[model samples]
Target chain A: MRRPGPLALTCCDPLAAVTNATARIILICSGKGGVGKTTLTANLGIALAQLGQRTVVLDADFGLRNLDLLLGLENRIIYTAQELLAGSCRLEQALVKHKQQPNLALMPAGNPRMLEWLTPEDMRTVANLVAERADYVLIDCPAGVEQGFKNAAAACHEAIVITTPEMSAVRDADRVIGLLNSQGIQPIQLVLNRVRPRMVANQEMMSVADVTDLLALPLLGLVVEDEQVIVSTNRGEPLTLNGNGSPAARAYHNVARRLRGEQVPLHDPTRERRGLRARLLNKLGMAGN
Target chain B: MALFEFLQRLLGRQKPSGTLAKERLQLVLAHDRSDLNPELLEQMRREILEVVQKYVEIDLEEGDVSLETEDRVTALVANLPIKRARPAALTAPSD
Candidate 1:
């Protein structure tokens, strides 16, 4: 006993707290609504799952939980997060399994009235559970700078702001990034969603480079306004599962791979449609349709 | 026939998809951020016009100010000219 005196304290010491650990929590937020935050979150979760990461999406929009409907898991919700918070249910009891994807699951938000009492500490506690249980946690945030926004943004380690090329979306995104920075979250990534190519070809819209230049954040993903998106969302399924050969699907997959620290190519597939006409037309001063 | 021609002009198919999306998205996002709705923007514009008229001889309705967003920043931008005040007369004008 006297010889083993020093080993007593070292071997049985408790590990560091999880909140202090470097867990990866990615939050998808947007200042404006109807810019496809739910759709993006669903596809991204599926894409991450496809990359072999056990991903769990937490729909932080308590009152309006469209992530489940978008993912076609509305009917699978057994126990909401409020039940777990109230001690009436356990953590695993709240999870809704994905239809066919075994690795993917969702922890849907609580009742509309129940979420009214959920504090920031509660969200962090939920994140702690997700960090312990899954490889990655993607939180879908509510739009605008309100109570819901604050609640969803509470436990995030990093953020991915979704925006369109329009000046208004970019401007709101700038304000949201400023708010995130003030909250000690810096270097947020930007996902330029609903980018239309024909407009850029005709000099009618902002380009990806233009949007990024304005936002000046890391480009996590650039998704086109594909017809498949509307179709998949209508069918209450994710676009990532809609035939991997599609451009939007490939973009989502590439986004997931990039998130996994892979050196995925960031080719602007729409670039070919630009300037080729000019090159064929004897090198005009500017390219236009 | 005139109404049909005006409708054709208003809903012209020649507009590029990017242009239309950008235009619609700009209007929506401006309202989305700053919590300033379309009605509020109109009211603000009217109030601003009234306030500016008291200070400057703005052609009551000529000058325009609007809330615009650029790259995630919202700003109240105005197109009014910065006019200087007229020099005061040395003495009162004769009747």
Candidate 2:
């Protein structure tokens, strides 16, 4: 129950440390639906692990949970958080390891029939284990500011809001931000997701500057709408893993590095897309040279 | 100033969708957060108008007060029109 340093915040800081552990918990939330919160969570968990931190992606969406489906670990989860909470399994017994990444793990949500309710103590217990076990914990929160949302958020040290470059998402994010502020949680950052770079260049979408001005929040990451995201989601895999060289994959990795406290350059959305010949010409070392 | 002109010169500029959408979205969230319906606001306006009308000729439309809902508030703002006081009593005092 201790507060963290302004920018020097970590998951298990003395301020929030129950027993002097060093794990950091991050809750990824959105105020409204269909704003890419789940996708952001999957990629973020993968990104943090890729950045060399021991990370766990906790699916707190319960009842209608889908993180396992997104991570392609649905067929692999024999037990879930609900099972662990209900004493049917131990915490480590339920974790589904990533197929290729050894450092990352996925704690999937239970099936609908399990019907195990999560008490406040259960949330605290799970959050404590996150602090004890991993370097970072990324919990994928459900949409809406409801019980499920509160359940997921109560376990985190800080929050990252995922909003689309649209009004509804930003508005919901604004509400979530206001709530976080009231709860005395500081260092809340914003992530603008699914941006169309071409539209920004053409003035059809909101520029990053415009969104920052209106939202008046700390900017974390800006992800473009890459076709690779669709292909990866369709194939039930994280685009950050095993996806071929694509802009979205690169962007996810860059965000991952930034989350680990690196200085990754922000994309200039207003730049027009170059033609293939122009891209080739630039790659041939004449554009900057 | 140079950047301002460059942005202005960018042709066919539409209203920033994110800003506008955020505006409309925040407007609704204030009410949603508090579970207050629009009809409740109307009822309060009418009741407030009735209470004031009993004292003086309170303007209804031009003397409107409003309630604005944002992410953190349901603020009541009154844009009241003051009635002129018959030209300052026409002679200061009838001394």
Model 2 ranges with Cα > 4 A deviation: A1-20, A113-116, A201-203, A271-289, B1-23, B26-95
The residue-by-residue lDDT of candidate 1 on A74-137, one tens digit each, is 9888887776666565556787878777678898998888665877777776776656557889
Error of 2 at A21 (Å): 2.2
- For residues A1-289, could you state the per-residue lDDT of candidate 2 as single tens digits? 4222211232434543334367778888888977777888788777777778888888877767878877888888898776665656655677788887777888887665543466445565666665556888888887888777777777778888888777667667877877777666667788888888655543346667766655667678888888878878888788888756777777778778877788988875546674443354345443221
RMSD of candidates 1 onward, in order: 8.6, 9.6
Q: Over the stretch B20-62, how does candidate 1's per-residue lDDT look in tens digits?
A: 5555656555555567777887899888876665555566445
The interface root-mean-square deviations, each candidate in sequence, come to 6.1, 8.8
Residue pairs of candidate 1 with colliding backbone atoms: A170-B71, A170-B72, A171-B72, A171-B73, A174-B72
Each model's TM-score?
A: 0.70, 0.72
Q: Provide DockQ values for all models, in the order shown.
A: 0.18, 0.14
Q: Of the native A-B interface contacts, what share survives in model 1?
A: 0.35
* Candidate 1 chain A, run of 10 with poorest lDDT: A1-10
Give me the candidate number with maximum lDDT.
1
Q: Report lDDT (CA) for all predictions.
A: 0.73, 0.69
lDDT of candidate 1? 0.73
lDDT of 2 by residue, B1-95 (tens): 14453344333243434335545654565565556578997788788876555444645669766556532556777765656434534454445
